[model samples]
Target: MKDAIFEVNNVSFSYEEANEKAMDQVSLSVPEGAFYAVLGQNGSGKSTLAKLLNGLYLPTSGQVLVCGMDTADEKNTWDIRQNAGMVFQNPDNQIVATIVEDDVAFGLENIGVAPTQMPGRIEQALLDVGMLEFRERAPHTLSGGQKQRIAIAGILAMEPRAIIFDEATAMLDPQGRKEVFAAVQKLNREKGITVLWITHFMEEAAQCQHVYIMEDGRIVMEGAPEEVFSLPEKMQALRLDAPAAARLAHRLREAGMPLKAGLLHMEETAKEVARACKLNSKA
Candidate 1:
């Protein structure tokens, strides 16, 4: 088994003056270079969990380890944040400079990277996110997707091994969401960077290697996308919908069709529907 990039053990967190825990006894592991998705609705502990993983918030109880370093230890704060970077919901909030390339260098500067070493890192990071052409452009003039890509490039320049995205696509349009997601996915696949993608979008989660569903600050479900989405009823009961294809596939199965469970994409669902119909016609 690959070494875990993140390990949460019996972790719990509660906001100050809040009546309930924000994260309750949650435990999970993210393997090195793996892509994991966390799905949850508003007020769920997903965002809080992201903060904890990045060492922004100490666990109210239990432990969170990043790259074998305990987050509770103040000494590991700097290295922890370096090893596990974060991209928040609003791209505007993350941008620190007027120029795109300067924004990319912000993290590198804080880490005390040498001036000479910075240009290469900045160029490569922008290239990786497909924003090299816009390196000299003003961030405020770019589209939402472009701005988000710049934010990702800034993190990439820091050379973090893992990234925690806290609903990073929530403020983006569909196109922007697609653009950001694709960039992050490419980094995971090609650069072997571990990702902790937190979002409420079922379609996005469907593409992840593993899915974790959070409700009321606790992990209500965790499995491969297919396994979890196959139970559309359970998902619906939680006031969440599975991906359209998964829901449709479940309905067909319930209606006496032998279509396979956990179909996610529309194309896959269409193919199965046709196959099932053909089988029925022969019968």
Candidate 2:
């Protein structure tokens, strides 16, 4: 991929004093401006991979390149992080300042963005996340999704090339999750920022352009959502379930109903099921 924003080449990582590798010989590329998902159950090495991409953890072996800068190179570390910002699972841990706008400006202040230019950048970032209206509000007063959006705003102010969301929506309620996902989707669609979303949410993965499934420190599956979720037995062996609609469609097919393979979303599944029923009635 000539436009690859992140290149993980034969990467492996292990914690100090740990007996096993968290990731083993894993390799993948995220194309520029693509919404990519890395899905796995807990202990699947997805989070470790996210940390390596952001320079929080160096690979024990192999290499990770962010926007073409080698992450393991000491000199390239700062630049790599600047180009590939991270949003972790906890929003509270990410926010620094009391007020929303100030929190968004924290990264800019660290990089010594000119005071005259800070307002414009901060305002834009907040606006991008749909949090401009709460610029003056205190961080603690915001909802979980709002805080996550603020965290994202902080990253956006730094003008990053890509963003890694490490289970960023896991802690939120359904509405909150929807809000944060919508904000991130808007960023990817309108601003053309590349996204790496690490989550166990199958529905979320279905929305991504590409999906990679990790298990036992390796990428066991990689493809478009339809291609991936099509294999129900394989996904089951990995201790992961296919998306709800896909599973339903599979069961219906096994029960002697005609249905298309790899039905991912509810709307599509409903239409297919209805069509099958109508055809059966005609017979």
Candidate 3:
């Protein structure tokens, strides 16, 4: 029922040099403040879609609209980029300043924010990402996750309504991934920022409100996380895996256990298994 923050209407895009389209007839709408996950194998157009949403790549055909502004229109390009900021895989690529606070100020500086107002925005953005304590530290001295958070802070300072995370956790270690994921999740939950999370990690996608699976530059499946992930065959066909908890739960169901659907988390799945055991013992 919420207003759409992003709308893709029957869009198709081909690369200048490639024989095949990078995106093909894709249509999707992301409501304001929604968390949407996009899953895909390599070269599946997920990244291309991110670029399109942020105005880095205009759709070759059809349309991509961010905050109701068409991306193909050159006039809307600047506002669209600010309206839908992007966080990419590499933190170092986005970190332009020496100190943590300074990096957070980079975007604000580009937009010509008043000198006096910069401090408050920088402080708030760092605080949102839980990196305020490290404000004075050198960016290169920080851990990967911390650097990624700083990268996020840079975007957050600009106060964009939406953010496109294009495999933002791909280069991180498990803990680093968790750190970055938690930060983004907090922003989505507390601040109501719309999120477009592009990832190959099934567990990460399992936690989102909506899921879309891409294969060969097209959306092959989309629904609530439970609905899309419940079909393991389609995931397997695309060379993707369901979350570990979901996979194990599916096996238990096949073995005649009356476990419920949408068991995406390990703790929840374990609890359900224990309850099922209790019922069996009673029987």
Candidate 4:
């Protein structure tokens, strides 16, 4: 598609001396400015796919394109990375500078961004991630969520077309995860930036516009969250779980209550339960 920010066509990849392909013939398209999620269990190849999109790993077979540039071509590597920035699980590994603002500027410095143009970019990036007030604070002094936002600010400084989170919230606590997730969603919604979120959390995946489920090195399912999570049996077969609301709805239905499928949010599920049971407001 012409609007695709990422085009993976029949791509497969294997690690050095690996016994088998980590990803096999995976094909997907991420439209420009779309929020997409890839869900999988460990060793299910989602992370490997993330690396391919960012040009960190080239496909062993077939092609991976980012904004019309082929990742296999050595010349496209630098531009590909700049356009498709990646945030890994560990924020500490991504932080290089002691101070928050300097860490965000580290990428701009490496790319030789004109010194005159850097202040505005740095300040805006920090503000975008809600970290401007912490510009002078030491990176180590910030909480996990703050550190992750700083990492995102670094990517935003590059003015990336897309940002891929490779289990970026895996190590965060509930509050930390909420903070980072909010920042990511804000960037996608407000800045028109594309997002490819790789995660195992079903609830997090539910927030995205599209979801791809991977199992045993291939895409086992792809659809909107409601479409995918409606099948509890298939999700479990892939070693995945439905979001809490969906699970509760499924159990209620099985117990002889009349409820609809694909109930993904709590408020909707609560309303449905009340209607099905003919409960009064007090109940």
Return whichever of 3 and 4 wins on lDDT: 4
> In model 3, which runs have C-alpha deviations exceeding 4 angstroms?
none
lDDT of 3: 0.92
Task: List TM-scores for all candidates, in order.
Answer: 0.98, 0.97, 0.98, 0.96
Q: What is the Cα-based lDDT of residue 156 in candidate 3? A: 93
Mind giving the per-residue lDDT tens digits that candidate 2 earns over 202-282?
999999999999997899999999999988999999999999899999999999998987799999999999999999999
**lDDT by residue (tens digit), candidate 4, 14-79:** 999998889999999999999999999998998899989978889999899999999999999999
Query: By TM-score, how accurate is candidate 2?
Result: 0.97
Give residue 249's lDDT in candidate 2 (0 to 100): 91
Error of 2 at 105 (Å): 1.1
The window of 10 residues in a row where model 4 has the poorest summed lDDT is 274-283
* Residue 53 displacement in candidate 1 (angstroms): 0.7
| TM-score top scorer | 3
Model 1 misplaced regions, further than 4 Å: none
| Cα lDDT, all candidates | 0.94, 0.94, 0.92, 0.93
Q: Which candidate do you rate higher for TM-score, 3 or 4?
A: 3
Residue 137, model 2: lDDT of 99
